[model samples]
Target: MSMVEVQPGGASGMTMPAAPKRRTLPGWAIFVIGVVGVVGVLATTSYLTGEAALTSSSTMQNTVTLGMPILLAGLGGIWAERSGMINIGLEGMMILGTWGAAWGGLHGGPWVAVLSGAVFGALGGVLHAIATVTFGVNHIVSGVAINLLGAGIAKYLSTLIFAPLSSNPRDSPPIERFDTFSAQPLADWLGELEQDQRAVISDVAGLLRGLVTRVSPMLLITILLVVGTYLLLWHTRFGLRLRSCGENPVAAESLGVNVYLHKYVAVIVSGALAGIGGAALVLGSSPSIYSEGQTANRGFIGLAAMIFGNWRPGGTLAGAGLFGYADGLRLSAGPQTVHALLYAAVIAAGLVVIWQLWRRKWTTATLAAVGAVAVYALYYASDELPREFLPYTPHIITLVVLALAAQRLRPPAADGLPYRRGEGD
Candidate 1:
């Protein structure tokens, strides 16, 4: 399913920062929980399946690959929302990024691919901005247009651009992807510990060893974006005004905040970030972009991450991590029927469990995060967990969750509102 943003107003007023003052879980707790959760799940699976001979490094590497793009996409969406614009074109931008990177990397260099993607991403954003910011077109309609354009272009161009697998040259790289490191040492023993769990523990451990999850520099870049965006949205003067425009454009215009400019910048920056996410995905994942319907529904997933984070960069980062981890588990485990169902249960139960724990303050975000992983581990071990519904069910659930969250939270009054010169205010 898609993770679209649901508008939850700022804690109080526009000036009131949306970032929470106290985390139920400390940063360290989150780190520890993530570590424990990953290791525990990997170990249990390895032992149960007797695939323990595989190295832990490889599994971790794979996990990082899956999570990195999700992280960036989520945060990129947050950046746009911070300034009061809703960019629903993340998937479109992602395709542009993918296509641009593939072409640039092949014809130019890897760095050229990255740069070209960024430029094209900005171009896509410009297309969106012209309609929504300058011409006062509906933001949703503009986004839909962008998505359609991206789909059409990707479909028509994939065959034209990509080299034939049967090319005369045998040893050439097909698409340009960046290689950051040799396998990290931490991956080996990270999930190898033996625990005393009775049912299917060994199978979990073996799977972890066999998995080859790569750690990307992109993860570090994503972290920086979170911190940097947090500072920009909450600490900077421009951020305050930008956010104000999103919440109430009339009030901002009354105060001379230039509503059109804010929307333009916000949307454009959103495009840039989304483009970066695409580049990271191509460089980090498999070579080149998907041919047709390549982006699938990630644009929607990104929107969900933005809403889940309340437009805060830090929260968005954590939210992205949650998604990334969930996606990685599928690769880490064996049968789709088994792991996918387990993942769905974790996703389904996640918000409920967090809300339950949150009601009593007994559940910290880290705990919620950890509990989510724990649920997946349990679901993975059992065959009776409704395997068939697992793979595709999460998509429907995600849409419902986002829509419901939208009901609970009021989006920026100007979410789909366009910005114009004299009339916008």
Candidate 2:
């Protein structure tokens, strides 16, 4: 008998039923799983080897310090892009903010310094809005111009104000450090450890002390800002209209929403956020002096983090935290620590491949296997991370992650498109 069965009183051949839909995991779920798995692997390794260097408090502190600026900048990027304007002058704005904060701190206090940076950053945003919105300049071109302007203006002011105070015009006078409070009893308790267990206890204590004491107000402010950004972008009426402009300005305008006004506001707020990021750097991180290049491409990194997080405040925080952790490793780890991490990553990748293969996910299994092999190859090639490679680790991670996730990432439809008044869709 033939395998095909004929339908009674119908066609000569019968069709097969459709296959069931595959139950794919949500992106956020997958991200959380990955995070948990990585943490588990690191924890396991630490416990087995009795090496807590990877999980030290100093590393955690560094992560927070480095992640703040990136997180702020990412939030700024999210705002600008969500309002139909692409503000790539964040770096320049941050530079101005650094200088502004320095000047303000010298004259007033730390809090005033933050306000001054925000004002300067808002000025940069105003310039961007005038170019892109009022004059119909290309967004990218306007951003580049603003960057040049910010750099030139900062340099000029530095020469005028800082030259007499410091030997180098590029360096400003040291400002009073931010106020820091510590948990004295906890710190003391952690300090009272045996010599054999000192490293681990101290690392743990450092983390507790960092949390309980010596904390800056800027850190709390940054946390509040992240939460506020989330609320403003998702729950507010203004946010809905601003997002509508990014999604489809023509539609928004037809619905009585002023696209131009919202875009201007968005871009301006973006600049203010970037400026605050700069202030956070100086007040929370440095607090000593303003130096040229202190922003150090953190604005660009923030942009990358925004993309990595798909332009959501929560996601951006996760991305920034990840990058910050990587940077902390680069800053604190010696050769042995690096080697251990590399091996751990390779093992994790291999285990993932095995799990995927077991689950019959052929494509994922293959990719994981390839990643494991590549990482192992890298491990074999470099016994120790070269000191010179430290600075590029974050950038390299940004590039690789973006490359892998680009196809799955989506931006607002009208993000980079120009909209003019009375222009028909």
lDDT of each: 0.61, 0.81
User: Model 1, range 74-133, lDDT digits (tens) per residue?
Assistant: 766766765566678877887787677666777776677677767667778889888777
**Model 2: per-residue Cα lDDT over 300-389, one tens digit each:** 999999998888887788889878877877777665665566667777878878898898999988998888888889877876777777
Model 2 clashing residue pairs (backbone): 181-213, 181-214, 182-213, 182-214
lDDT of 1 at 224: 81
Q: Candidate 2: where is the Cα deviation over 4 Å? A: 1-35, 45-51, 183-213, 351-360
Best by TM-score: 2
Return the TM-score for each candidate structure.
Answer: 0.70, 0.86
State the number of backbone clashes in model 2: 4
Most lDDT-accurate candidate? 2
